[model samples]
Target: MAFERNTQETYYESIIRQGYSRRDFMKFSTYIAAYMGLETSAIGQVAKSLETTHRIPVIWEHYQECTCCSESFIRSDHPIVADIILDKISLDYTLTLMAASGHQAEAAKHATMEKYKGEYILCVEGSVPMGDDGNYCCIAGRSAKDLLIEAAEGAKAIIAWGSCACNGCVQAAYPNPTQATPIDKIIKNKPIIKVPGCPPIGEVMAGIIVHLITFDRLPELDNIGRPKAFYAKRVHDSCYRRPYYDAGLFAETFDDQNAKEGYCLYKVGCKGPMTYNSCGTIRWNNGVSFPIQSGHGCIGCSEEDFWDNGPFYERMTGLAGFGIESSADTIGKVAAGVLAGGLAAHAIAANISKRKELRDSIRTARENEKKFES
Candidate 1:
């Protein structure tokens, strides 16, 4: 059976029907606003929008992926985030979460697409396999590529969830037998928001949806189509061990005493310095901890082509405009050399000034002695 809903029902009405108080709704708004880096004034705006706006119809698609994105989204730290965005909201069709399956599921998806054409958000959770005439991955006897094109034609926008949908993840790695292709590559006309991670932070997933629901528009994106609010800073910039990195105190190995003392993990193949994400700040598992906090170095999962970038346990030797083969340790060595040279020059200049002072004193003494003799 198709899951039915009242098309005119607002989000707040649904929340209230679900037994959430106005206070709970406001609190959720505040929490989401904070996560979005919105000003305090915007909390009311967010609340107002959610209260009055009808829930957006979302058709979430699954393709060539591990389904980690779905796992992460449902396990969002905030119970209400999962409840409101996934359940109360008009998530009309999702292969993984919906009760309807087989023909019933297909019926639900097609109905939403036709009824809400150019309005419903098409959320794709994986990549499309383009190789072998798109035969590697199929759903309902159709290639993922064909289904994606059909769905995207009527979508208001597309949310490419996780690295798989954003950048083809592991399936698109070396030799890519399936030739997995990201949604953005397949859909050119639509506005696609890329949230890239092995499985992005659950709160981040919720925040993006809330942003869309609040503003009736996509959040401000960076150069690569990722939301700026969460991906603006590098993980290294907010990492707790940043001080150790600046002081050149790095853990040489995962089991070293320096690691126990909480030194920077840069030398042990930490990719935090190169990775842009909110992991250091927002954290994972309801703000309890993330990879870095758990003593493992960041694997730089958010960046494009991360699987092909380099070995996970090795630090990046160079980034764009950083000079070829120049690692952090090399830069530190050069900085130390410059500091030593500057100190030596300062000492030499001080010595020269002292000698000049001595010469002047002797000249004054000689003149005084000559004046007394005369």
Candidate 2:
């Protein structure tokens, strides 16, 4: 698998050669920087990096899961993301997107791996099935495990895209017949950046790539390996209906007047409070609306083992360590108690401040009267 070494073109050069204007390129850079949670001053830095840095060679592998991650990537809000970020990169191999198949596809992947060695990025899209000696999923007459190990050997970095690759997704859910396993567990000794979601938001996917391209390093990750910029905040923290939750207003059931009024959906099984994702902010379909905005509670798809957590429509109130029995009937009572306690503490503090102010006023008046008599 020998590849001719051609001059590697920078991302900006590729875009310009493809007929995108300079303005368009910089605008795309600014958009990427914002989504990557970079400071305002970093817009120029992003543009400069894209202008000079050679496009990263990528080998995208797919295995035992749906192709929704590819679907989401293609449907990014701006066509430039697909055109510049994905297309401009030397994407040597991807089972779903590459037109070449069979021997041609296998050749391309090997060529990139051999040529780039430890410089290329390995993007894995699904989990590997190890049940029955990895018989569950095979590609080109070889098990997925064999292919993944071969591809990952010389890669500089690995990206586990979507929940399937990150946490084995639903394939490894309760009573999993295929014994699907996540990439991190299979491949040790490599730092994997996990982008966990049923199919992560398109912009979020692009943001991760742009960060890698600009910084020449992986973005900061939380304990779970998800990028901190996107997974740092819970969906509930920024949810529009958070006010309702704080005020003890909630929808008991779907299609009720409370729901129509956009009250909190905690009782009907919203997982926003427990799930960390950028859905409430970055949103899907170009920031239009997410699941909650569409009148459905969060299913916590981003979290690991979400499928086995419980029924999707059932509120999980019997959580351990909260010292409270949880049920649909008792949710309102809990919310009310929290609100009442907060109000009482505020009132007590205000009374103490008011008494101190009056005491000071009387003491000052008496001192002034004594000084005048003297």
Candidate 3:
């Protein structure tokens, strides 16, 4: 378990090695800054951090789930994100992408864990099954629980990469057979950031990494440990069809005309109002479209136990909260009325001002006439 951390490499060093220009690296940094919703002034900070900080050593562990998280990482739009995060990322040690197999791979993980102990980042992609002493997941002859504990022991921080690792995902859904467990449930000490989604959006995943690289710290996390920048607003808050929702218009069925007309999907079990994610604003697949934009209701995949939340197509049984259903229903009408009233008030004020001016002129003329007579 004894090892040494990898030397920090300069951005120029990585650029030369990767056959990319220094300009290319800077451009990537700028894109990253923008994607992370950073201010224009923050481009410098992002570039500076990437240029100086050595590539963070990462131990990405996979457990009782599909490899979608890894899949998403490799497909990030930014060239730097894909290259630096997955391909070159594993040039160090990741079980899925690492070329070394069997004992060699195991040895590599151990070496990185030891050498970079308490310095490397741990990226866990799946849930650990605690039942049967963690028999549900075994890697290279080691139980998943044992592997997680061993890997987490020397980590600087942990990133729960998908709903699986963050909230036990589907594997831990209702009547969970294996008793899947999230990272925070087992690893107590490290600062764990949960990027919860069935499979989180690629840029969101990359943005987190960039924020960490740039800020030299985790981005601000909400109560659930998910980054607030991406998970702060409900998907409904930014949906293009939100005005329709506020106007009491809704799509009763997926194929209804209202649906075709881009009416609100709340009637079709759209969880947009309840779920929080950047999907509506940042839309998946290079900002092309998200579920709601593609004529489908938001399944709310980014939330905890979403799979167990019930049928994705079932409408919410009843409206909750006082004004949300009633008052919000008339929002569009209310806003319009207020605007009209404001215009009328301005006109009345203007007319009064003009009348006052005319009266003052007449009085002044009369006073002049009297003075001349005297």
Q: Please give each candidate's TM-score.
A: 0.84, 0.84, 0.81
Which residue pairs overlap in candidate 3's backbone?
Answer: 3-115, 4-115, 118-154
Return the top candidate by TM-score: 1
Which candidate's lDDT is highest? 1
Model 3, 270-328: lDDT tens per residue? 99998989888878777888898898899888888787665688664332343434443
TM-score of 1: 0.84
Worst 10 residues of 2 by lDDT: 1-10
The TM-score between candidate 3 and the true structure equals 0.81
Off by over 4 Å in 2: 1-7, 317-374
Tens digit of lDDT per residue, candidate 2, span 1-100?
A: 2133232789888889888899989889888889999998999999999988988888999998798998898788877888767754557788877767
Report the C-alpha lDDT of model 1 over 108-227, residue by residue, as the tens digit: 999999999999999999999999999999999999999999999999999999999999989998778999999999999999999999899999999999999999999999999999
For candidate 1, the 10 contiguous residues with the lowest summed lDDT are 316-325
Better of 1 and 2 by TM-score: 1
Name model 1 segments beyond 4 Å from true. 1-3, 316-374
Q: Model 1 Cα displacement at 162 (Å)?
A: 0.4
lDDT of 3 at 363: 97
Residue 190 displacement (Å), model 3: 1.0
**Would you list the C-alpha lDDT of every candidate in the order shown?**
0.90, 0.88, 0.83
Cα miss at 369, model 2 (Å)? 67
